[model samples]
Target chain A: MFRLILVAALACVITSKDVLAQEVRITPDTASFSVEVNGKLITIERNQDTNHKITNEFTKTSRPCPPFCIHPISAAPGVTTVGELEVIDFIETSVAKGNGLLIDSRLPEWFAKGTIPGAVNVPFATLEPSNPYRDQILQALGGVQSGAGWSFAAARDLTLFCNGPWCDQSPRAIRNLVDAGYPADKIRYYRGGMQLWLLLGLTVESPNA
Target chain B: MYRIVVLIAGFLIAVSGMLFLQGGQRDPADFALAEDIVIEDVAQMSARTSQAPATDLSGLTSAVRASLSPETVAAPEEADDMAAMTSGVLAGLGAPAPAPGGDDAMQQATAAVLASLNGATAPTNPAPQSLEAIISQSMQAGESDAYIDALLNEAVTSGSVQVPEALMTVDGRVDTRTLIAAIVQQSMGSADAAEIQAIAAEANAGTTPRAPAVQEVAGERLYTVEQGDSLAYIALIFYKDSGQFERIFEANRDVIASPDKIRVGQQLRIPG
Candidate 1:
């Protein structure tokens, strides 16, 4: 899988036919990147069709506020806000290397429709302390069980996102994690979530499908 | 002497069953009573068969006798009805469901008894269903094209169902698509109509009022759009990979909302 990723990364280095016509680059230097996800080679590149605008339900702009209100640029004191590139970079590095998970904090139904490729769904509700399986999930994320709560001394890095900047699912998830004594610095908040990712025409996969 | 007595009993039971069915068909009151009577007969026969371990005929025999019980007397009537209607439609649909062991012994026994009694005892086959009737019914039932294809093959060979002259390929094989189209004449059996129109309006819905228009480009492998031309079918024609239809759809998304809605006579780019 690693070799496949390396080969894909090399393949992307070669100029594409579209690039010769009109280049759309992820960064000044890099055109695309590849990562191995569940033994499948997931090559993350912007959609080549410039005219391809998403036709899915994610196009809603005027959702009523309390749930869809614009979130803070920063969720908490130590939680860092990351963009699509940072999220992509984190996926290629931390997630692929098994040191972290890029989490889709939306509910499972929303996650089923389409998600940022290489993201794993851990819905915000499941992270609440009220859930009996909360500690089990924390343990899965490399948290050690202590007598009273949990020890995040070895907690895995988690980058969480939901529907977009207006969505609070990820923020609530972060709060849940922080309340359970998970280290805030270990959690990275991707404020763009799915909407901006689709707007930019980055690859979205139906992992649940 | 024992054999003669059993045969005599069988004939009497069959005659009574015919009378009951004729009467039941006349009176609407007997229909629900008939179903209940059939259920009770199955229960008794099922218990008898489990104890006896004899042939399904033995269970069927007892069930026929049990049908004459004061309450139901509907088993033999049901059997008489089953004998009269043995078309592939009812042969496939009308039987009681079979249950595995530990679920319901009566259900299994009922299905077994019916299977034995229902099959045409002699080689003299009844007139088969008409081709149009078979195709429309099977399609309405949501059976696969392959299933309908197989059924058509059997019907055509047996000289029962004739594939219409128009649906016959140049090589003389039945084209199931065109055949289904003959039944659903409006949208040519395209799924796009089913997608847009309300399900209640589905049978005669031609939601796409415009005829499929094709754009021909020079120096391309041009294929004319026939009725029922889907992107997947076109991809199969060009690349032999139906999944590659997505590529054509991406190029043509400006006109159609879905790949399925692609009209006839549009030249698709064959990406090398």
Candidate 2:
């Protein structure tokens, strides 16, 4: 009787797996993932509909080039440029573990439009030396202040992304971070950013939500 | 017969008066309008931030302009008047336009304006969690009317939001046309002149601007290893990334035979 029951359970599991195959996934090996954002559980997944075409403002192929110029794969020396899968891994491993941050380094209005799940709004402008709260932000990022300079003994690994390859906000942010003595090796740039993230039908979340 | 003659005479006199009124002197009081003229420059600067009726007016003007062909375009004077009206409507918004310049300049201007707009609340919050935030979030999530209605309903039921009776129809439905104005007014927190005055106010009631105070400590840096100190910790203190411990280990080969072995109170030179 126990053998018969085991066989039946195995059949049931197989049928369920077959049903799940019809849905979209983060990758072939991964279906959906959840991240803890601001103490809330947000599930990040691709749109299930295969026919889902992007109709938003991000669909425009042409943007005026002076500001929206395409950026290279490399952000700067020692800063590792990453893709969407790595970003997911970073969010899960570092951000979920509280050892890292995914910085959406765009202006607040742009950030308000939409962003990656588990990301925090740290506008690129605020990271500059001009902003009065720059040190406070540094401190919040685990920089210890002494008379000499900031000690990043416990600094979080930050992965920054903006509005994709055409967007320079993240690159500008990476430069500023390096200028402020943030380790380039610790900083990762998601060059694909929002544009590619959306193009691939990956999830986009709002900070307010 | 006398009545007919009188009516004809009255008609002729009225025609003469109409012609006279076109080019003759008139009372200035006849053309009186509101004294507190909202500056078009202020309106233009505010631009997209306002949800006032003026925004719709401006939107309509632009829409009209967009829909019309150049051949069918209105007179230049009429177009100018429309532009002026659009500018006037724009003043009701809270945004401050940046000086015209290159792309970087424009982006910086946007950043500056956003920073100032956000300053109305706690300095720590990057964006205001107002009705606009709700709509923005909704747009990001799903811009369907049903979704927005559900969101607004949730907000109302949660008691964090209060829609005025004027904003509601007899059946308690939100009036979509006036809702934009309500959102803007809620975010602004007060009437028009008060907002303009607040912006015009001599930049007080904010933190005094200060230059970047980061003193350059870039000379040949040195550190005294404390108890339980490792090359990694020292590297972290100096370079902000513990992965760079190798740089230190390579530099201090004479003092320490191995990268792992660092005794307490050992002096080491940290490279800049």
Candidate 3:
């Protein structure tokens, strides 16, 4: 009887199937990926432009990969995409409350031209597109800083903007974030670029000042 | 006796074989990474310690360089301490806490807002436990509409709760808990009710300047794209993504056509 039971158990174990096949998903699912030599990671969205090249090159700014490193990524179905207006409102309120940074998805030169005040610029080109640099960028952006002085961490309520609604800059940058494995809800894109700001008569400054 | 021993041995052999097969089929790659885990914890330590502002690397460039070389990553003990320092710094600078008396004020203010709109306590379903826990968990999950009815029910079930007819607004369209939270947080530490009134007036008016404070942005470089500037390639040069490039492109689109097509030296606006 015991032998029969053991055989039955083995058969059940072999036949009971629930696991599913995995696929290669990009880090910043919405952007492109470039791997750097130092095992650093860098992600670039589709819109921003700059001429300053330091090191490394990639086919596209983002791409999907079979989840590597030490862990697995799982997701439940039926997640919803939150709207841009809600994110903008949250950022506006958060900024008023002194919460986090609103990153401008422009090049250093463009950043010099004009941008929302207190925003940081990280042109996606200079990062490694692999296991490490993705985290490094987060650390560098006052996202996750260290030392006796002040540090920053990127995991916050961030609202990103570039040109305008038809403009793909902010969306591309947001894609980088999404691909970098950040949840879609955490990122907010402002589709209107400087045009909307000018139209609204908010504020503008020349890059040379 | 031999037959019995053979049977026992066969059982053990079969179990061991099964275990081996199971282990073979189990791929370690199929694991989930909760946000906090790092890929190379030791490598992370070396990177942080090297970047530490206090570390003296001036006179000891060679030593610093050697330590940075992949082979000599920080020792286990040193890495642990450095990692701790890194985490401490992160925690210290991350998520600011809600202001003093903020929760109560938020509740009251939301109640007031709801009263103005609804005339009764905005109905909520009875939640399993606490509102605070639910909210916190929602924030962690990025959002949660789960058990909202329960939460409302619980709030209504609490005794002596004043339910005014005026609080019940037409269409049941009430202000959200988030709006009240924002309002109450802004009112914290105020010395005057008049100031609170004024602030509320501004909030209600919605004409308050929504943009962040302006800063100096002059003398920044200009990179106008001539026709055929691929967003990906441009992002590589800028160390940002093509999305950021579009920010530049759209900001200056009046001078250029599509982000895909731009003339050289278009005086593209670059933020300072």
Candidate 4:
């Protein structure tokens, strides 16, 4: 009886070890959760289509050059380059807390197509220094007006992205914001953008939908 | 008592033997081996660490890069050429010709404009109308619809006007006016200011008097949804009044379910 018990115990230990060895989890812990955007809670999950393929504007291989060339990893000094996971974490921590913004810097058409969950559309052209609406937008982004200048004391952290690495709209937007006196440290860049986000099988939400 | 002691001793020996064997089988990849189960635990830990955040950015970048096709990989260079070509075509349409000597792109653009104009006028007038003469005549004539069409057809036929594949409709036709506008907008600095103004005036002349506010090009006046576009915003762009978004919503009722929602890549009719 004692020998039989020992054999059974040994068998139990080996089975548990084999079971653990076969399990492989690749997604982040927060991936299974939901995120709140524009007063609605959106569940984050990859597109469930078993035969899913990227079929958006991002599938295009080229665009006008000079103005729309591939952007460098870093937009400017002090602005950190981040990927999808970091972007998700920021959405959870900063955006959900209302202390930061996830900015989709593409034009309205691109924004209308689809975007990463939790991102708000802010076209790069609308934020140009010469645009009459620039000051209004800056103020809305929590910039405070001081005497003869603007202060970013109350400004929320901003993470900007556009189509992907090959897109310059977000880089231009980031540079424009930094030039407009928004602090560089307060800005983070998701260099991967929509292309990488989709590639990694992350969720995308359309504003219209 | 002796039997119980022997059993305990046997268990110790078996446990020690297992530990000893595991120590000999230590994986070279492991940094430490505090427990017999450390190998599996370390693998899980390494995988968890990879999924944690930021540490494997290079790996992710490479994966994304690998997944992208070679066409996408070679896009930047092709984009520059396409942009130059687009600028050249727009310059040909009505914008001012680039300076006598500029970059290769500008030079090619100027040549393309000359070639297109030469082709358009070659059969009718032995001395081809200079780009300046054509623009001046079109503006003075105030007959932009026919004039622009003739010019675009000439350019398209000559293969000088290479519309990017993205701009092509399902039927493989391109929107000449939008193509012209995109090129003009993109090639702002390269084109002549007065010429651009004249072209804009002529283009707007045809659309402003139309009751439906549609540019009277050959087909339906359609606008593709761009990033950041809303119904109101698109209305503001075409109709100059955000309040007229309902007009667009009404026009696109078949495809559009909600006035507030518009998808990118959706073709919205700019009802006349």
Off by over 4 Å in 3: A1-92, A96-98, A126-134, A141-154, A206-208, B1-272
Q: Quality of candidate 3's docking, in CAPRI categories? A: incorrect
lDDT of 2: 0.60
iRMSD in angstroms, per model: 37.3, 31.5, 21.0, 18.3
For model 4, the superposed segments whose C-alpha errors exceed 4 Å read A1-31, A48-51, A62-64, B1-272
DockQ order of candidates, top first: 4, 3, 2, 1
Candidate 2's residue-wise lDDT over A1-209, tens digit each?
A: 44544554555555455456658888898888887744668778999876577897677654443345689998988999999999999998998887888888875556667999878777676665645456777777778888868788788899999889987778888988888888888899999999899988898887665
Q: For every model shown, what is its TM-score relative to the native structure?
A: 0.40, 0.44, 0.24, 0.42
Q: Write the per-residue lDDT of candidate 4 for residues B189-251, one digit (tens) a residue.
A: 444333443443344345422122234446779887754345654554565444567888888
Kindly list the per-residue Cα lDDT of model 2 for residues B121-235, writing each as its tens digit. Answer: 1132233246667665443322444445566757766767765432333234443322432343445665453332232221112323222122334565556665434454344
CAPRI quality of model 1: incorrect
Standalone chain B TM-score for every prediction: 0.27, 0.21, 0.19, 0.22
* C-alpha RMSD by candidate, in order: 36.9, 32.8, 29.6, 20.9
The candidate scoring highest on DockQ is: 4
Residues A120-190, candidate 3, lDDT per residue (tens digit)? 44432222132133445554333543453223334556666654443334554565566555555555555
Give me the iRMSD of candidate 4, please.
18.3
User: Among these predicted structures, which one has the highest TM-score?
Assistant: 2
lDDT score, residue B188, model 4?
61
Q: Over the true interface residues, superposed, what is the Cα RMSD of model 3?
A: 21.0
For each candidate in the order shown, give its overall lDDT on alpha carbons.
Answer: 0.59, 0.60, 0.38, 0.59
